[model samples]
Target: MDVKEGNELKEFNMLYKEVDELYHRIALEIGLSDSAFFILYSIVEFGDGCLQKDIADHYFISRKTINSSIKNLESNGLIELKKGKRRDMHIYLTQAGQKFVEEKMMPVFELENGVFEEFTGEECRQLIQLTKKYVMLCREKIKETYHLSSEDL
Candidate 1:
């Protein structure tokens, strides 16, 4: 890449890391670990009885990390797990969990919504489209670099 392209890539990476850091700070401010916050956020996004696997896959987190956060949330009385029809566990928010989400998670959702509200519809669409394209291109490059097949990813 040329110098300008390289600098642009660096700027993009810095912005990405900064966004992640902002979320981590929000998690800390709400008295939760970053993983725990994301776990709860996933539950809120996906609904009460979402599967742990689904959360992990959707968030690109490892199952092990999801499991650890699940244990912590359960211990804190924020969530409960029950066996599904297929014998896999489904997570549910407890009564306290519902209250906790109402207090903590909803504001974050609102904040996110508020940010989007500032963007025009076309801008929002372009942002999402470009981001998805960027991710797809990155994944393709990684697979090519490592000689990986689709199944491996």
Candidate 2:
């Protein structure tokens, strides 16, 4: 690749690492395990009563892992599980959980919003679109190399 493309690729890798580190650091600052923080963050972003399976699917994580996180969150009075319309469990944040999100996690959301505010609306939209396209390209490459489909995954 040319120099410009190579620099962009390097910056992308660095951004990924920096974001991951920041996520972990935020979890620590909020006194939550990384998994618990992620679970909470997902619920907050997606809304309450989200399905356990949905979360597992969203993260491409095993049900057992999500289940463990759910249990831990419930034990800490951060979340509650209720029977859904089907046999699935619907997860919701408790009053304490809401408080925790407001106190500990909202700052992170605000910070992200503040950063986004630095860019124009169109720039942000284009960035998201391009990133999603890049992700799909990588996924397709992985599937092709592995001879696997989404169903297999």
Candidate 3:
């Protein structure tokens, strides 16, 4: 790449790391581990009765990490697991979980919504479009470089 292109790539990577660090900071502020925060966040987003596999797939987190976090949450009585039809477990928030989410998770949602409120609708659309395109291209490049198939992803 030319100098300008290389500089742009560096900037992009820096911005990506900054965004990740911001999430880590938010998790710390909320007194939760990164895995736990993401687990709870996914549950809230996907609604009750979401599956462990769904959370792992949606968030690109490892199944081991997801399983560990689910166990922790279960022990705390913040979530419960029930058997689904096909031997998979469905996760649900307990009464305490509902209150916990209302107290802890709601503020994070409000903060995220507030930030989006500052952006124009067109800007938000562009941001999502560009991000998705970048992710697709990145995945393709990784696959090509490693000779990986879609299933590997």
By lDDT, the best candidate is 1
How large an RMSD does model 3 have?
A: 1.9
- In model 2, residue pairs whose N, Cα or C atoms come closer than 3 Å (at least 3 residues apart or on different chains), thus clashing, are none
> Cα RMSD (Å) between model 1 and the true structure?
1.7
Model 3 worst lDDT run, 10 consecutive residues: 1-10
Q: lDDT (CA) for every model shown?
A: 0.93, 0.88, 0.90
Q: Lowest summed lDDT over 10 consecutive residues: which window, candidate 2?
A: 1-10
**Residue 135 in candidate 1 has what lDDT?**
91
lDDT per residue (tens digit) for residues 1-153 in model 1:
646645788989899999999999999999899889999999999998999999888888999999999999999999999999786799999999999999999999999999999999999999999999999998899999999998877
Of 1 and 2, the candidate ahead on lDDT is 1
**TM, every model:** 0.95, 0.87, 0.92
RMSD of each: 1.7, 2.9, 1.9
Winner by TM-score: 1
Ranking by TM-score: 1, 3, 2
